[model samples]
Target: AMFESNMLETKQREIVINDIDPDALEKLILYAYEGRLEIHQDNVTNVLRAAHLFNISEIVDSCCKYIEKQ
Candidate 1:
């Protein structure tokens, strides 16, 4: 679940991402800024994992759709 708006006030200003693959993280960040995903056969699984962890619904949905097409 996502954090509440007030959670940021009492918490540290930084976020740490661990466990996720670097390539996946890089692609997810690009997706966050561009509002589009480059989901492909090779990267789809890692991308989906990153999207799920980061709560990027749009990317998750896009990755799901891409998987469905396979």
Candidate 2:
């Protein structure tokens, strides 16, 4: 595995932020950073999409559990 010093790498972390609005993306980043999230019911789908995209497995599962419990 060769990680060059300067070249851009496609093997970087899989975070698909392009599908989200900028403000919501910022919020998601903050949640991942701080472990505290303030999400609305309307935005659950967006959050689930982000969690799935970023390979945050636990978050995706938790969202599923929460939805099932609702």
Candidate 3:
């Protein structure tokens, strides 16, 4: 919706995501294309939060499993 809107038609064509960790965002983007990502002690929490916010169930489930094992 965001991309289909006038936001993309503008000259800037930039979508700003606020209040998300840069590293978590990068991991989510990679996971979208690769179908996999690393969930570690350092990033699991942030990644899980980001995944939940984006409604990415796969990542959220994986993060939950990783957390449970810790």
TM-scores for all predictions: 0.72, 0.60, 0.85
- For model 3, residues 1-70, the per-residue Cα lDDT tens digits are 5556676545465668887898999999999989779779999999999999999999999999999999
Q: Could you give the candidate ranking by lDDT, starting with the highest?
A: 3, 1, 2
**Under the 3 Å rule for N, CA and C atoms, how many clashes does model 3 have?**
0
Per-residue lDDT tens digits of candidate 1, residues 1-54?
235566654476766668888888889878778766777999999999998987
lDDT of 2 by residue, 7-52 (tens): 3454676534467666556657877899866566666667777777
lDDT of 1: 0.83
Which residue pairs collide in model 3, if any? none
Q: C-alpha displacement of 1 in model 2, angstroms? A: 11
The parts of candidate 2 lying over 4 Å away from their true place are 1-16
Q: What is the C-alpha RMSD of each candidate to the true structure, in Å?
A: 3.2, 5.0, 1.9
Sort the candidates on TM-score, descending order: 3, 1, 2
TM-score attained by model 3: 0.85
Model 2 scores worst on lDDT over the 10 consecutive residues at 1-10
Better of 2 and 3 by lDDT: 3
lDDT of every predicted structure (CA atoms): 0.83, 0.67, 0.89
